[model samples]
Target: MFFAVFLHVLAFAFLVVGRTLAPRNVPLLRRAVGDNSTSSGIASLALDKSSGSYYTVLKAGDSYFRVALDTGSSDLWLISSACTSSQCSKVPKYPLAYKSSTFQAVNNNQTEFSASYGDGTGVSGFVAREMVTVANITLKDQAVGVIDSSNVTLDSDVSGLLGLGFPRLSSMSESVTNSSPFFSQLAQQGKLEYPLFGLSLNRFDNGSLTLGAVDASVVRDVNQISWHPVVEFSPFGMESQESSYLQWVTPLAGFGTNGTTLSPNPSYPEITNNASLALLDVGLNGIYGPYSDVSRLFEAMDGARLVDSEGGLWAVPCDTKQNMTFTFGEQTIVLQPSDYFLGRTSGSPNLCISWPAAQSPSADGVDWHIGTPFLRTVYSVYSYGINNVEAPVIGFYPVTNSTTAQADEENLSSILTTVKFTPPNSLLATPTDTILPYTFNASVAAPTTGLVSTGLATSTYSPIFQAWTTVRSAIPTIAPSYAVFTDSSGAVVTSTPSIAAVTLGSPPGWTGPNGAGRSSPAPIVVTVAILFAALGQWIFCFIV
Candidate 1:
């Protein structure tokens, strides 16, 4: 009997080790395993006071500029001048100022290169780099890819995106050999106190990005557990093996009621499997993972189909309306119907939802991406590691309504209004204007004046033509604006005040400045040009 028991024990040990061991690449079955635990003891420090800036550097012409920083995608690229295509000129262009400075363009004479997004959006540019300065810290000699396009979604405060991730794969990370990733560099230099970063995405400002430390005031317990290096090559191989990280797990008492009580896991009484991991991301705007399992863990009101964009996984439309609840440790969060939809379909009366479904798979198992929807719902913290693995705690704060859905019913708007502008035309000069063709840049701001909600206007009125300027000036609201007007008087009024504010649909009485035509060129200016000296330096680095 004793011998038999020893053999059984040995067999069990082998099973655990075999299950834990995995290949360099992630597996499909492993990622499908149901692991609903939340990683715990991770606290992220808050740095709401700092300004997040996205800077750009051109390679083809050795130019540099600053744009907005977006955490929605994983690519460090720029727009260059060599791209003489009409579309390239329309987007923001980099100035040729590096000719006087010591910069390098390692790539060839090819004026354009292609950078593809998970979405259908792709830009062409040349890859180059130079010493970049951020928060007083200057990195000498870095690699940057410069593309050409004017349709980029950059604002005045937002110049370009600086993706903060592990090294080896990142353009900024691999380019600078001595310098580590942006966040890693800060931690190594002892610039951060807790080795963590925090983010509070608001409707105002450029959404907050805090580096170097976690906000202690926002977290429950600080020294709850010992930190470990982040695990690469997990069950699905979603992470890169470039470095070490940790995932904090906790055993919950149980699933509770009213979002407060914890129940017992009858199958495993003493062992709770609620584990949560720290995700250090800057390119993605939202918290990601399975809606029913990892990340949010909340169920939608209705079942939706899964749609896969070229860039990432998205939710599909479903015929039935549904509702469900998710229990995250002590926190219980609920999602609304509109939160599930990405946009409204023109053919159908319903909206197109945006959520990740379990059906899709990328080259590497089932990939996960945190999009803008998720970002708007959480207050995430990313901690920079100090002394390599010894870092502060990281935290994930769910954006709860604070008050229940019943509390703020009055503030929510059932109808949305947008604005638009039109050129000075006959409608304003002469009355009885009938159906006149109109068009505007929906990618920019909505129209603000001379908007029409219904039929053609008979009265002469001029619509505001500065929708682009007004929308660009909006501080933090992502909801693009629009313009509406009544067609009482109809001559083309390029500039008139007879407009009403509209929430949905096209701006009223407004026409594209270029009129009703598809082939309109965007207006992008290449502020100032100095010289192309950086391109020459970059060539020398590759030759030697």
Candidate 2:
């Protein structure tokens, strides 16, 4: 008890006085990134120690920025010489003002940009054109956001951010009138050998980001790519009542050992959508679902209970033997207990937390987002239609049957090197931060679930404060958008949320120090017989 108290107090001290300074400058990287020898490119991957977010080194014009790749939102933005906010001061910023040759500034009111996230991080800036090098492609005059102000505190950990979402969702979507994003432009220009790419990651060791080609080495059987079409998202929310639409969506055919389909049956529908839809998001870290559906799902496992972490996360007994299997299209995935029991609380018999987060960041309520923990077990190819078979499709292939794989599955780089799209560039791959166990968010909290442009369409703010204010006032009332179900006879039906939707109130805007992949359990103050007992637990938290 004394140990927990002492660390909690120390953590609080760290939060107040411990500020990690970001590297203020790196040379305007005049050199190109990756070898310009091949049609495809490969980037090494790493996870952030503090935030548990993933990022890779990317060269933007004259400088190399460690940028996080986000699939939930669009816009390649970085702190810049123009930013004057406190958040801006801590992140690595490019001297756009001094690097005139590399930074081509665009200053029209229309060119100025802004974005807000569910966690309340917002960046307001102007759009500019600059050369960007990723993998093997040296993209010229790519649109980038030079943040002039921000509410996000990046702790200088990452230098910038890269958006991997659909172009229409880009922060500059209005400026280009919804044109193609940087990667899409590569596809349009035929610079890449293929229209799509694949990312193979491991909990430990290293992973690869294969652009323009799916890394065949990661999958046991490349022929087993189970392709499923993506369902369109319903922005208005009402359209879901008649039909369902969600980003990267697909029908969840059935569940259970007997393969019970989605139905009016209360047991399953309570925690799951009546409609049976699940979205595949690489940006989020765990599978999420509405409160009721997830509650029901856990009920099946003895000792599985919901614990309200900062973002409504769930925890299950570590000894749980429940085998949760999911069906995607024509394929089935059986999850080992390790797949869901992601973290543990300290003690002789540590408490294991489940990997599934039980809430959605959006006002739209909860639905499932298949993220990092789930993807690690399989090989996923997020495909864009260059072959013309379909515009956007998700292909899944099982790659592991391990009961518990705490480390990387295996380095298939050697196998990938043999069949690489083009003789790969000999660019350097740097090692990243150490991956830590779940530590009661003795760290931070985070996620990027969807596009943040709904409220950005019209906003004129003065510096950082007003910019975040405008963003908060703009979040549209969102509720559970759509649902899907599979009938016993194998027929699939999609439906809308039955609850009357209410637009949520304006947000607090840019929750301070937004942590994208970590959890922040709400503070719990427990009392013991002695005052020392309280102090011990508080400080003990920091010990982790």
Candidate 3:
């Protein structure tokens, strides 16, 4: 009995490695990576393809601006051939009439930076600290905003707006002493390996921007990362003086239009039915609320309709083949009626403008805003930790194969609006290639921006600013952040492997996006006695 067949094959190989060991929740980024340390940064991907919007190239000293990467606003500003704002040749200016030696003027006389946007668009620049490179990370001085003047509709591929929110919402000259975005000056000069930053986008534009690491190839399921918790509306937001963590805000948990549940007008205590509180805005490409919760989410989408079109904009209906879910902290995320439909108006192909409406609503306590059509379907994380016991965190990892704008809803081309920023497409990833860590005194390559397909959006009506559109519908479709599932050495498994990770209440439909999930792990039966390991190992191999 060959020792009872090797004790039943070593007890079924330790119960199949303890039942295929699926236990995780690892996101303190592995005890903050030390004993060696590792983090990375190397952005690539730019697509305006007619206003589906998505940008980031940034060079600064030798010309290469495109910028537009907003995590919900902060401040970076470009457009400055000393701004003669004829809307400045459609945008991307800053050559400062030939690199005035990479402009350094931070303040021989500061106080003009007055910028503004949520789409109302405004810019009045003058705040330079320069040097700025990206890819190999180089800040030198940083604080840039030279604009001089503007009307901000943005095109020419896109030439301004980098602001990754918080530095006290830095408005450059909001009275000085404030200003440090661009990853908080790359984590106050230490240059991130731990401060965090990683956005992936796809279906709206190409993707990949990983400063300080997170792009282990755009995570297929870093175990199910969907963390969310960067809240701060402190005494009504912009927390002046002793705490303004400034916006990246979150708290949406509801808003489902094809599977039911669109309720939230309980007389509007700021939309309290499962508690509202949105504003995930990747620098607004639309999706705003409070016109009575976007008019009951377009009347729950059945041949949807909503027109009024003046400045408060709303014209939804170029043919809505409906699909939009969005509920967080139990996770929901789904968007694909061509991701929010923002086109066909100028000559009206029967109309089609549904970004959700807001660039014109007053009583600014904020009602809703989750833009970039739900950030091209997820994989967005933002961190700023290094203190406060490692605070600041926000994640959502669903996008698995998102080649970015996945053929824009079936081979669609572009040409819808402006704010264009063109000039970088070899398929993208240039700074002289090699995702950079440094080495490009001048091979020049950062211009990439050719995908512009969002044509027809020239509106102007102000009888107290109004707007809308509508038609066609459908619903109930999610639970597929694109799926790929890997682990037994195939490498790629993301958030959702937990022994502890479920931070507090989450799990009604998705234990994903990034917090991974809190608990439920109660299954480990392993009862391998096998006749006490084959008669006590054959009486210890015949009593020794």
C-alpha lDDT of all candidate models, in order: 0.30, 0.47, 0.48
Q: If the candidates were sorted by their TM-score against the true structure, best first, what order would they fall in?
A: 2, 1, 3
Q: Score every model by TM-score.
A: 0.46, 0.62, 0.27
Residue 37 CA error for candidate 2 (Å)? Answer: 11
How far out, in Å, is residue 324 in model 1? 6.7
Find the candidate with the highest lDDT and give its number: 3
Ranking of predictions according to lDDT: 3, 2, 1
Q: Please report the TM-score between candidate 1 and the true structure.
A: 0.46
Model 1 C-alpha lDDT per residue in residues 76-159, reported as the tens digit of each score: 454444445654443334433324254566545243334444323445556555555432234455455555553433322122
10 residues in a row with least lDDT, candidate 2: 1-10
- lDDT by residue (1-544, candidate 2, tens digit) is 0001011121111211112221111111121223543266666555543333456666676555666666666578877756778866665565653443666666552477887654435678788777787764677778888778887656534656777766545648557553346775665565654455676765532345667665544654555666665544433322222212224556566443223323212222322334355666555555665445555566566765555433344455454556666676667776655555444433313235555545422322224556666666676666443321223556676766643323221221111111101111232222121222321221111111222322211121111112112122211111112346665678665532232111111112212232121111122221122223322111010112
Specify the highest-TM-score model's number: 2
